[model samples]
Target: MKFSKTLINWYSINKRDLPWRKTTNPYYIWLSEIILQQTQVKQGLPYYDAFTAKYPTVFDLANANESAVLKLWQGLGYYSRARNLHATAKHIAFDLGGKFPNTYKDLLKLKGVGDYTASAIASICFNEVTAVVDGNVYRVLSRYFGISTAINSTPGAKEFKQLAQKLIDTKQPAEFNQAIMEFGATQCKPKNPDCDTCPFNSSCIALSKNTISELPVKIKAAKAKKKHFNFLVFISEDEKTIIEQRQGKGIWQNLYQFPLIETEKATNFKSFKSLIKDHELLTNQDFELLLYNKEAVVHKLSHQHLYTHFWIIKVDKLPINGINIENVRDFPVPILIGDFIERFNF
Candidate 1:
């Protein structure tokens, strides 16, 4: 009771004035949560504003085209979240008649709503006494209790979740959940936490034991896999260019990009040009291939690092399905390709 009260008290004075915190609407809360996942508040705020303004309601989001949603979500990364969000919005609007689930269990049924998101929406919107265990919650709890269990481990997850549930304030689950998470984010941060001013500094186990830096342990992730991508940028005399929509499940699925030829490893210009010469898109076409970038553009994702090269192919005529070069900006592409387009100057 004291722990919960202390956190809520601190929260009242220290919590950020975020837009989502001001609303109890499940749609708004759910949208904020999805955008904030694996994203910093500073980086995610603009996207949240854009999404809410554009959609305004669940029905609007459901009615929006996937391309538009992806376009709005561009540069935010984690594109699958955008796709799942679109799918879930449609399901809610059409199938459920625009009513978001009120309980954690029911919310879990949504395509992108996992345990953390479900719990957040359930508690914040519906006043359900469900505890939300996200990265911030894990950090706050582990450091306060001096728990050394690896947070990524299954047992660690179960233990921390159980502890958080037991510590939640039944009378004010929303405030308690937000308080603890806020405390972790602003005070008990991952690096150089402000221990002297923290509400729990006197009694926090990690603070007393000088283990604040080591309390919330996480297992190291595997090395990012390296991939080589050679994008063929076709430019025709008639101001047309070729862009292909990525299909199947993988990075940047459903996004548009130039014709690509991936290699097992980075290749020299001569070897890469030879590979492009045999490409089906260039079959029997008289073209001049020029390497746009001598150095590979390294784009890093969570699990993969992409070494990309843009090959500019000047052609007399483009394929029948090619689009005008000026309109390429309208298509949603990965930030890697998007950056290239912005810098390539047509």
Candidate 2:
């Protein structure tokens, strides 16, 4: 097809020299794909380098501690992705006998391995003809073909997937997938794309119809839920600090953070003072406020908007059975906690 041919030709001349594209190693490809998901290239590139440099192989990642893995993934939001990546790595190392799954169907069985990822790996590593559909592919195809279906809906996904499959260069699925995605990223971008110079501009339905800005319809996400977090940071006289590992089925699970007191909305100073005075553990006269953030620290997640305030309290004595914190940097913390710690020299 001219669309695939022209796009592939453009890709041959314009594709970026990414590290993952240099090898057929499924291990590296899997890492890159996982790290890049819901992440931008420039932001994720350093993390990919760090992971490959430290872990080096699937075996290394599989054997490494969860804290270490999550620490390396510190700034990357979506802690679940890191957890799943580690789980899948161990499964491949122990359960699969260090062999990467060669087929799209088999790869999908791995944790966090969905259709797009499986297809990318299967095509790039094993030369499978599976078509990969991602955000980039959706935008490119929708604009090119003037498909207005909501890409997130079930029917829209199926329609786009079928269209992509039909247009794919079967003999070179790997290159085709990469080419279409790259085209979307660089040429057929989501906004303000330079269509005048595009190879497909003459035939692009969206460009011709003056609807380049809104071709790929997607269901609007619900507004993020707002939450209030008041962290009580206790550092003992001997430089010991209190940090607890998050255990619930929420954001930052398994990551460390200060002792938190959550409320429905932002807590004012008066209510906070009463809470501190009434609480059993906090009312101990031995502790004094060292640092209190009067300004609301806002942290925005995908599904939640957190208004955080930190109170760094100095304690004269460490409580009985209190956890010992030697190095603040040793623990894996959420991006919000990590930023607070780093900025305040904790």
Candidate 3:
């Protein structure tokens, strides 16, 4: 009771005035939760605003084209979230009569709605007593109780969830959940927290034990894999180029990119020309190839590092499937390609 009350009190006084906090609408709440996943508040605010302004309702989102959604979601990375968000909106709007599930269990049935997201929607929108154990909650709980378990471990996740559920205020579950998460994000930050003024500083086990930096430990992830990508940028005399959609499962699915010719290792100009000579698009065509960047551009993702080289192919006429160069910006592309488009003059 004391712990919950202290957190609630701290939250009431110190919580940031975020737009999502002002609404209990399930559509808005769910949107905010999905956008905030793997994204910081500062970075996601504009996107949230853009989404709300553009879509306005679940039906609007459902009716939108996937390309538009992906385009709006450009530079936000982890594109699967946008795709799932769109699919779920269609399911809710068309299949569920535009109704959002009111319970955490049912909310989980929605695409992309995980335990933390479902709990957030259920508590904030429906006032259910479900606790959310996001990164912030884990940090706060581990430090306060001096738990040394690795947060990413299965046992640690279960133990922390149980502790959080046990501490939730039944009568004020919404406030308690929000308060704890807010407390963790603002007060018990990951680095150099101002423990001297914290409400729980005296009772915090990690503070007393001086293990604040190490309390909420996480297992290190495996090293990222390396990949080499060679993008063939086709430029014709008529200012036309070709961009193909990434089909099937993998990174950047459904996004557009220049026609690709991947290789095991970096290729020298002599070897690259031989490879291009064999390409069906370049065969029997009078053309010249120029390497766009002398040095490979390294694009890093969560689990893979792509060493990319763009090879510019200049020809008198492009294939019939080519698009006007001016319209390239209309297509949704990965940030790597997007950055290149912005930097390279057509």
Candidate 4:
């Protein structure tokens, strides 16, 4: 039997009954695909259900506020996905006149709808013959075909995409796509793959040679830049605190955070006092620092490590320029900052 047929046969009997698999609605399919991009299936399912339940259709998502969308996606991280999802929904609702794109080519034109995502939505929802080549599929094909190209490089992506397209079973496009991905997810996993039980184990190159762990070659990742941030949490007598929402492009875009001072070196009390005084931060008198906490939390991003310090300050009045008195729970904040608030409670 051919690889595609064998894989589909295996999938029919062994695939997990996921919530996304039950529906052919492109909106929900797109939601699942986007949520599952950087997240594991187990972690992503609840988020998928939450989003779909809250915003049932593209119109619902498109009509929602950016803050509300970000708030719902608070803990999920990789916020660009949420932002793009919203943008795409709006495009569909307004420009496309509330009609979700049904074809792979049309879906690809939407914001953040890359080849893999477009293909997944197209095949699963419309039965289009589009190939989806994600990390799992990359691993499966690299090992099966004994391809040595670095998976992240341009040449590697092109080669794998071509293989995926050629190997796709046109008659059962949806099943073919799902099976290859599911096979990679369950049996041909990144680490400790269960080759003995896999239907393709008999002919799988990596299994035959003990190269399963090494087949999916990846180039070394660049080192993450380390940056330090000292957050000043100014609390009024009424317990309201000063906060500001980050604006413009870059990390933590449009997320609410407390007043912060970033420094290359760890900030000391004397330097902080001098710096604030230089900036004329306080109006009349020097604000007294009640207590200084030594604990520094390290939040890791894909390309950076954020070393954050929380300084609690009690002030007679809030800063007139940079601070806003708002409920922290009501605003959209990054998950790391949210965790910081929960841990400190101020």
**How does residue 67 of candidate 1 score in lDDT?**
99
TM-score of each: 0.98, 0.96, 0.98, 0.95
Q: What is the full ranking by lDDT, best candidate first?
A: 3, 1, 2, 4
Give the poorly placed runs of model 3, Cα more than 4 Å off.
Answer: none
lDDT of 2 at 46: 96
For model 2, how does the per-residue alpha-carbon lDDT over 55-161 read when each residue is reduced to its tens digit? 99999999999999999999988888999999999999999999999999999998998999999999999999999999999999999899999999999989999
Q: Per-residue CA lDDT of candidate 1, range 160-264, in tens?
A: 999999999999999999999889889889999999888788888988899887879999999999999999999999989999899998989999999888999
**Candidate 3, residue 28: CA error in Å?**
0.6
Give the higher-TM-score candidate: 2 or 3.
3
Clashing pairs in 2: none
TM-score of predicted structure 3: 0.98
Off by over 4 Å in 4: 290-292, 321-326
| Candidate 4, 1-346: lDDT as tens digits | 8999999999999899999999998889999999999789998988998999999989999999988998888888888888888988898888989878899888889888899999999999999998999989999999988888999999999999999999999999999999999998998899889887888888888777878889899999999999988887777666677678897888888778877889997777777767666444456555666434675688899999988887777667755643334467788888877887776765
- List model 3 lDDT by residue over 98-198, tens digit each: 98889999999988999999999999999999999999999999999999899999999899999999999999999999899888878899999889899
Name the weakest run of 10 consecutive residues (lDDT summed) in model 1.
274-283
RMSD to native for every prediction?
A: 1.0, 1.4, 1.1, 1.7
